[model samples]
Target: MISAKLLRVLAPKIARRYSSECAKDGFTVTVIGAAGGVGQPLSLLLKLNPAISELRLHDLVDVPGVTADLSHVETSCKMVFFTGTDHSEAICGADVVVVPAGVPRKPGMSRSDLFTTNAQVVYDFAVVMAKTNPGAIAIIITNPVNSVVPVVCEVLQKAGKLDPRKILGCSTLDSVRANVFLGEATNTDPKNAYVPVVGGHSGPTIIPLWSRSNPKLCLTNKKLASLTKRVQEAGTQVVKAKEGKGSATLSTAYAASRLTYCVLRAMKGETNIVESCYVASDIYPGLKYLATPLLLGKNGVEKNLGLGTINDEEKKLFCGAVEELQKDIKTGEEFVKSKNVK
Candidate 1:
């Protein structure tokens, strides 16, 4: 009884309403390497989220204990533990798979140094996820993320299921650090401050675009350089303060959890969701990947926001960062190629 003209206009709105209703039911999220420092806290935070109806924790060891610990928390979400060789079991129905596995960086060790060991660890896990949860979003938070992410992409590609949009490097920590440091410099509330940190996650390669800071505060070249250095070395600062016990586990866990939540909210088709992450892209033309502001939606990275603008001094830093990042990207790609040959 509906006219063709009216049907065309109303059909899209009706479909959108249906999709929104379906998203309210939430999705299953799996945390691989869920027993580590970052993983435990990240899981606890996710369990507290009403948007997650099911949570699965997987690790090579101690998952039962971690599961037991989290299961006690009174929440409607069902929690499951899968340990040892059952990694795939955890990922079976995952809407998102978060990886915070691999060894933590020791004092005097660079992120690149963690590459050899973490690459193998990440690749092994990526293989399982690619097979079991091929469509699920993969969030890589392992140390040396600049490389481990590439390893993940390569493994998924080999499995014939590479979707760049679904694979994201959790560079939110870098963004978090920039926000705090900028907040301190400008005497503003860190909670409300938003700073865009682009490029890779390690030293020299990390770039905090202060020019794009919201509620723009004028900063001199000297002050800007000092702030930039502080943001880049914030991780090392945490390591030194911890005095060789472990690297920035607690803060990193907090930052990773925030990112996981952002992805979950976006997948629920929540409007106006935006966050920055290191993702596979041609955004910078010659670069293999770059961390830039990302618009999140049901499909993960919906759009790669271009770098706004940079002053002369910032431009110089950007070029230097791109140069160093090239080495990191090459190292990751080469490691995967070498392993596949063997």
Candidate 2:
């Protein structure tokens, strides 16, 4: 018998309660590259999501054992796996197709350094997904999001099924990091911190809008600069910390899972569910894609809540990021274009 106090202590946090908004059926989510470091844990997290009906895992490598492992977990979500060269069947009727299928950043590598390998990796997956599940929300978590997003969009365009709104580059990890950091620095509950990170998700391109955060802080200029750098280079920081072993697998999985639920909530008719994503948006002057907090609903991106209350320093961050983001986008687009010509 559990004590009432213990039960009170054991109750889930508010973020987890978002899953309560759904108890519906037939909401399948397909995770590509499901046997990889991020994919395995992300699949496990989504397995625990009561909102997800059927959880499908797809990868080049055989993942039946991984599926078997998760199937034994005491969760209502059904586990299914698709392995070795055929991914379309797994993605066919999924409500959301999440792509975390790409090479990761090593200690000396920048996210752009991953482009040549991951570009084709993501493009191939997006080709199948674009043809198979055009209506489903495509949440991209492949690195160099600024680039791969545009590459996926090109696939959809070529397929004649382009819906810019549904193609989202998963940038929620930036927001997750920003919120927790702000919460710790200001002694506020991280859940309530709610930081909106904008720009692209790479190096100088990732911008955490500290001035716009809820329950704001009055940090000195030095503190603000440090915090900004921390958020921007957090992935590199993780790679270094791990001594080149891995890059942000666990936290990336958790953040991607969080966004997955947000998409699910919208599909199940929940309102006011917002999360940041890098998408094909003309929000900025010179960039085609940018990460902004979007109000998610049934059709995906019900409304894009524009960046709010940016300070001068934040503006400088955006300016510095534009050229890099543009180049990344071009690299992705050119990769697909070159393939098409070949």
Candidate 3:
């Protein structure tokens, strides 16, 4: 048996190894809607991460309560709350700003239907971010993300602070779902499965690049089609499963946190880190924006990794997805233009 002194001597070495595994470099993360369903859990995950040294919780309401609750979880990170009309203080010095502050979709509601209500909310928050954390990498988790991301860019543009590299629509949930469903179908471990999901975040627009997936599992044409459909409709499945009480809040939080972890790791200069996110794109030549593979770095978006070789059937799906995505992009642009005119 090891003596207490020997155990103490080995503890620091163990911690260093663990930190290396977890990539624990200090980062300050601000969760804009810290009181909401996704925000609360996302914040908790960040706080638990040894990589994060500080967590700033901001919300229009209940921030203090949320901060108080999360602060009790014994962790290395310090928690700070900025509540009620003081949005600027919360984002003032953040390295990363996560916006999960919007309403959920109802049974009969399309994501676009939540636009009028969420647009102003996201726009107002974006304005604050422009002034305070202008250089921070902004991860947008609000619904109608295709539109909301454009709205964020427009807001930053109006402030003359738009940086295409710094804004991303958090579509990692779609990628996560794709991997999970594919794993379930193949009876493979989800952690080992690598799937790339592109396009917009809403129904019919999400494109899973099954052909480009690593480990290249062969699926019958029928099974492949079924898997693709399952990935696209996964959100609706969760909604129906919940019987209209809530959407995919918990799973979304998990996915968002995973994406945030990748970004944070990349921000610390960890090399070869790649993740898919919806950002201003030039990948498909004429397409204005897309969710594609990106190399994240300390300066944000080291490189926009374009799509790999896709099969003929996949190309057809890609074309259809881009068409729907263009409409989503236009809807966001129009919303911002109207807001500006008003």
Candidate 4:
């Protein structure tokens, strides 16, 4: 029985009230493999997230100190530690689960080389997540992501809990590298450049579509090819630079954090949140899944925005990527099947 003029005045205030109330309900995020290079920094970054109410760190070892270290950070989010088999507690009721567990990639070792070991690790986490928190959005950061993501999907599907939209492979590192390198090339801020990196995560499969870069650049064919190659081999460059000490960790944590924030923002009902991630998609034929630009929303990937326009060079790269990616994906699916994981 409110008057029309009064209703309009109160509507904005009511909406603001609900938003503020929702903010209090914050999210709980769990990090599996929370002690490693990427996990430690990633956990610290998540600690800074205002919308996160709880940050759970789980690792086979070293979690107690890692949790204690992160607890000192001034943040509203409550920190929880889970070690050994008790890591199950971390997954319980988690809103988002990030898996970065597995052995670090040694120099001369490719993501695929880590696959045999990482697949089992990723599978174990997936099984627990599917059973306990099937509703949680899973971000798989374990390498050989092109394969690990599929393995996770298959596990969830077998458990009758598969929600493709809720599963994402963290390929944001590739996108981050592309943005930084391209920004450097153009004298633009990396934050301002939007480069859509599609295909897969490993060498030869990682395709950066310069034709679709926002704040686009004009470059010769030679320069474009060089930049694209740099994006694809950036990981290897880091591995070599580390003198076999470590792979890319700091930059990776930053990229993973960026992706996590994108997902969190979308969960908050933000509109038009687009990120490039490796997920199950129908964007290309023959390939069951690939990394493409996705418009994220409350339930996860709201829509799959396929590769826009690729130049001749990109098209050629895409063709080669499809061939290699298909094999990599098959390797993952086969790994799960071989384990009698149906």
Candidate 5:
């Protein structure tokens, strides 16, 4: 017996109430290397994220202490810890699983050098996720992401749980670094500088598209090359600066959290959330996986959003990146094949 005018007003209110309830439905995030330098800070960031209703910390050692320390935070998010064989418990029912569990990169070492050990670590985690939380969006922060991402993908495929959109290699760090470095050179705030970095996660495979940078920067070819090189070697620079004690943990955590937030927002049905991630794609011929900007959504990456406009120099760099990136990807595929991880 409601009037038409009353029904119109009530309908909008009901819709708003439903939206709020959906937003509060509780998101669970699991961190695989929760005791390491990257994991500790990454957990802190996840703890502070309002979208995450539960945070699961997993590691081989010292996870209990890390969990206890984070429990002191005033956030409403509940914290849990799992160690050793119980890592599977931490992963089950997770909405997002982040893998930063591996050996830290030392000075003078490329991400590829950490391959053999990290590949196995990432592989084991992928196996667990495929079995326990196959639908979860995986954000892999392990080194040699170009390869490790492929490793995870192949494992998931074997389990018949592969969703290309749900598995992502967190190459947002490269984009974050590009923004900061370009900000320094251009005297603009890094927050305002949007640089789309596409390619793989290491060395020449990291392609920073200066031509597509927001506010449109015009630099000489020499200057452009220098900035791109800096973005590519930025991790090495950080490793050396730390005197081989650590790699880029702080910045990496920030970037990973940024990407995680994007995923969470997308899960809440927020639209147009775009970020760079290394993911499986047929965008470029031959290479099965590469980093590019993706439009995130409720199910993870909704659109591939292939590389935007690039000039001659950038195109040449991209061609070279694809060649080297393919080799790294093959290495990962072969590693999984060797394990016979079905």
Candidate 6:
């Protein structure tokens, strides 16, 4: 973690790159993989958010049915559907574009295992996001986010529409898990629990800082370590329990919706709206991105609240996660380079 003095000096400087755009009313939101497991449930939750005025759903085959189903809900959110690969209409002018467009994991499959196919799927959706609404907040919920987020950044940068401030990889799930696990371990209410998860989104790369937990936890070292490991391995545990049927769709939808609401609420002028997200950052050396808590605002990231003070064990975990994330980010940048770096 960086010093508070240094963070105070640098946060706003990094934040200045984003637009100061604000919204007086509700905003238009688009879901690129609206028919998928995570997308369907996420769309339902977003439809219920009072901040969204329009919800655009797009997919290859089943989006119409999904959108039609969501439209029946008693909400003022206007619904639209776009079938197939042509996402120009659905994505255009959206206030926020969320891409959960990728295949999910099965039993015994690591997140990295889905990188081959999901990377390309996320890449395609990102292209449309860059082209149609470069200024909109782009939230990525695809698997292998440690890599695919860099892929999206690369694609948008190539298109001359890169805005590091607004492009976020929704790492909120790790934080959500951290909160729940911490709460459960401490025998406190989960809703009152809050933990800041740093590093990347998968495996050993997920670092949950117990020092920052709200309601203050006082667990033994053994218990703390076990809880941290549980948060990192939670996705795998879920996949195994599902017996090859699906991944963490329901929980992921809930997590992604939390992130989406943060962005929407920020855009609508909510102050001090902070969330942990994987976005372009200089919080840690040698890695272009890390999941750090950020102060959200009208435009996007108003300030990066760098990882606060962590314990010896937390630092050790963070170091290892950083090393792994460096490779993960390279995997993403390399993919983009191979495809479009002319």
Query: Best lDDT goes to which candidate?
Result: 5
Note each model's CA RMSD in angstroms: 9.4, 3.2, 4.8, 8.4, 8.5, 9.1
Instruction: Specify the highest-TM-score model's number.
Output: 2
* Model 1 lDDT tens row, 127-159: 887888879998899979888888888878888
Total backbone collisions, model 2: 0
In order, what lDDT does every prediction score? 0.82, 0.85, 0.82, 0.86, 0.87, 0.85
Clashing pairs in model 4? none
| Candidate 6 lDDT by residue in tens digits, 73-133 | 6667799999987988988889899999889988866656889999989888777777788
> 2 or 5: which has the higher lDDT?
5
Candidate 4 per-residue lDDT, tens place, 22-57, comes to 387788999999999999988877776777889999
Assess every candidate by TM-score. 0.91, 0.94, 0.91, 0.92, 0.92, 0.91
Model 5 TM-score (2 dp): 0.92
Pairs that collide in candidate 5 are none
Q: Residue 219: error of model 3 in Å?
A: 1.9
- Pairs with steric clashes in candidate 3: none
Q: Runs in model 1 with CA error above 4 Å?
A: 1-24
Candidate 6 Cα errors over 4 Å, as ranges:
1-24
What ranking of all candidate models by lDDT puts the best one first? 5, 4, 6, 2, 1, 3
**In model 6, what lDDT does residue 52 have?**
77
Q: Candidate 2 lDDT, tens digit per residue, 60-162?
A: 8868988998887665778889998878898898889988998889977856578888988888887887778888898899988889999989888888888
